[model samples]
Target chain A: AQSVTQPDIHITVSEGASLELRCNYSYGATPYLFWYVQSPGQGLQLLLKYFSGDTLVQGIKGFEAEFKRSQSSFNLRKPSVHWSDAAEYFCAVGVFGNKLVFGAGTILRVKS
Target chain B: EAGVTQFPSHSVIEKGQTVTLRCDPISGHDNLYWYRRVMGKEIKFLLHFVKESKQDESGMPNNRFLAERTGGTYSTLKVQPAELEDSGVYFCASSQTGLGSSYEQYFGPGTRLTVT
Candidate 1:
């Protein structure tokens, strides 16, 4: 079974600060990784995905994630996070095209 | 274009009651999915529908849960004799195609099912 781990449960940062959310996965073969964001009382929106080829993947809303095979990590980053970026972020690993194992989310709070 | 749409944005039912959640996928989308997030837990896949067919339902937890996607346009998940553990946000997502990496699922504002 594939599983994902997100170390941070909550993170607080000042607005306009750079941010990084860590994600690690455990899979035997090559992994398909993704990052998703969710606001309160809403559904998830995909931030980005990494399947093959490039290690660095860019996503919507100025978010990016890098897949590191050696460390089994796909960390999401934003150079400058706006107040609107505050949300619960999830990391996931998919296999065989059907199910996805998600990580416990990291709630990001932006301070003004 | 409208993204996925789920009906009954919120539902509160007593334990042992029955509830059904509906999801209307985008037109022309062939792939539809059901996922849920329990309190303080990560979202988990419940099933997948390719048109009206159940392509994969391995994630479905038990017999009390039923899902259908008749006619391939919309899908529904029903829970009979709901348990407290079933209280959570149920999300529906759809993509144009299921075979390729281009299938990025667009999600609907979930239906929060609260079992009292």
Candidate 2:
């Protein structure tokens, strides 16, 4: 069984501040990792995904995540936060081609 | 292109009542999945349908939950005798075949089901 853990339940950062959301996973082998964001009254949107490639993967909306195999972590990061970046973020781990296991999710609050 | 779409953006039902949620996947997508997010809990998978056949349903919580996809187009998930714990947001996602490294699942806005 695969599982994901997001340490932070909520985080507040000022606009233009750097932000990082922690994510750790437990899997038997190298797993597929993904970051998704959900705005109010919206569906989850893929931020980025990590399969087998460079450690750092870039995604839309100026978001990026690094896959650290040793630490079993894939934390999402953004250089500068904007007010529009306030949303709920989720980290998910995919098992083979089966279902995905998601983290508890972290709510991001951007303060101006 | 239009994303996945679900019906009845919000539904309020009573305990012991029945609620059916509909999901229309992206055109040409062969894989459709159902997931639910209970309050303060992680989103959990319910089932997966490959066209008209169910590929995997190990995540279904109980037998009371029934999901079907006819003509390999749209899918319906019906819960008979709904319980208060069943209150949550039901989300539908779809992905095309050979998703490769970009195995991204397109999602629907989800239907909020409230069982009071």
Candidate 3:
């Protein structure tokens, strides 16, 4: 079955440090990859998406993700972490038409 | 433009009671989806509605859950005889375009359901 996996359940980083969140997906064909972030009391916001073309996609809030087909991965990255960046991030793959298969999100903690 | 909006940010109800969650998509969006995330679990797709039609409901758990989008406007999800295991954050999302690069879905603040 097609599925998405976010290996790290939680990650902590000091403010201004680089951040990377890993995501792996298993799919028969090239899937539509996406990154979504959810704050404590907010909705899931679209960070970035990879449908076709441009392996690296830019999203809102200074977030970007690279889709590596060979590795079957779409990892989210940010140059510097902000205290406001502490949130739960989800990686999802669109399959079977328009539905999205999501990974068990990873929670990020930004330390001072 | 207004984003997707869900009613009742949180709901706490008895196990056997029925609760209904409502979602109003962006004014022109025709595609709406329902998802649920159990505590410490991945968010799972519950169903999808294209306009007023049931596009896909393969992920719906059982018959106890009924979802409807009347007149392709706002949608509603009603859980009858809610179970203890039904406690989770229920999210509703809407996308403007269909099966294209514009498939980016806009999500609403999820309705947190707690069945006691």
Top TM-score hit: 3
Candidate 2 is graded, for docking, as medium
Give each prediction's DockQ, rounded to 2 decimals: 0.60, 0.68, 0.77
Estimate, for each residue in A29-65, the C-alpha lDDT of model 1 and write its tens digit. Answer: 8787889999877778989988889899999999999
With candidate 1 superimposed using the best TM-score fit, by how many Å does residue B19's alpha carbon deviate from the native? 0.9
Ranking by TM-score: 3, 2, 1
Second chain alone, TM-score for each candidate? 0.95, 0.96, 0.96
lDDT of 2 by residue, B3-109 (tens): 99999899999999999999999999989999999999999999989899999998899988999999999999999989999999999999888745325688899
Number of the predicted model whose DockQ against the real structure is largest: 3
Models 1 onward score TM values of 0.95, 0.97, 0.98
Interface RMS for model 3:
1.3
Tens digits of lDDT, candidate 3, B1-116: 99999999999999999999999999999889999999999999999999999999998899989999999999999999899999999999999775654367889999999999
Backbone N/Cα/C clashes per model: 0, 0, 0
RMSD of 2: 1.1
Q: How high a TM-score does candidate 1 get?
A: 0.95
Kindly state the number of residue pairs that clash in model 1: 0
Error of 1 at B78 (Å): 0.8
Per-residue lDDT value at B103 in model 2: 55
What lDDT is reached at residue B33 by model 2?
Answer: 93
Candidate 2 docking DockQ: 0.68
Candidate 3 C-alpha lDDT tens digits along A10-102? 999999999999999999987899999999999999998999999999999999999999999999999999999999999999987688999
